[model samples]
Target: MRAEAQAYADKINAALALLRRFIDWDKALRRLDELNARVEDPTLWDKPREAQE
Candidate 1:
């Protein structure tokens, strides 16, 4: 590939990587929200999962 074309591709990749950072942050926040919703419900511990004791 030509140098100019390669340079453009590199720039696009860098921008995409930066954009994915925001996407990752959005997903993390969503997961935290779901976790917080379940955690604050207070009935999640009543299901009786495997006990470590």
Candidate 2:
């Protein structure tokens, strides 16, 4: 029972961290867009091969 409760607490902590990261998705997206536009003519490393995978 103790182990199960600990696991649940850990899971809740992880979820809270993720929720904080995405709480302001709109602001984050806007910042990303601003950075994208300021990039050079060729553009930032267009191929995010690692991200794609």
Candidate 3:
């Protein structure tokens, strides 16, 4: 029984670790804001290469 419990805990910990790696909400939000700001800029289209990027 204890071994089963330990295995369950290990699975939970592994899932938590994967979640931590996959989700960076703050950084994602900041990057989204930056893209929004860039899109709002009129000068964004002046550089064709940069605009394509």
Candidate 4:
């Protein structure tokens, strides 16, 4: 039972490591902040292409 629990824990840790590599939290947060700032801008709607992104 202990061995099985350890194996599951190892698998979960490995999956978490893979996800950390796949997702850049810092960059994503920066982009979200930029988008939030853009949302407050009056000119955001002026550029249809930029607003749609």
The number of the candidate with the highest TM-score is 3
Clashes of each: 0, 0, 0, 0
Q: Report the Cα lDDT for candidate 2.
A: 0.75
Candidate 1, superposed: residue stretches over 4 Å from native: 1-23, 50-53
Error of 3 at 30 (Å): 0.2
TM accuracy, model 2: 0.43
How displaced is residue 39 in candidate 4, in Å? 0.7
* lDDT for residue 8 in candidate 1, whole number 0-100: 100
> How should the candidates be ordered by lDDT, best one leading?
4, 3, 1, 2
Compared with the true structure, the alpha-carbon lDDT of candidate 1 equals 0.78
Q: List the residue pairs that clash in candidate 2.
A: none
Lowest lDDT sum, 10 consecutive residues, model 2, at 44-53
Q: Write the per-residue lDDT of candidate 1 for residues 1-53, one digit (tens) a residue.
A: 69999999999999988988778877878988987777787667777572211
Error of 4 at 5 (Å): 22
Q: Compose the digit string of candidate 2's lDDT tens values, residues 1-53.
A: 99999999999999978987878877877988976665643634576663333
Tens-place lDDT digits, model 3, residues 1-53: 99999999999999988887999967988989999999999999899899877
RMSD of each: 9.5, 9.1, 7.7, 5.1
Q: Using Cα atoms with residue i matched to residue i, what is each candidate's TM-score against the true structure?
A: 0.46, 0.43, 0.53, 0.51
lDDT of each: 0.78, 0.75, 0.91, 0.93
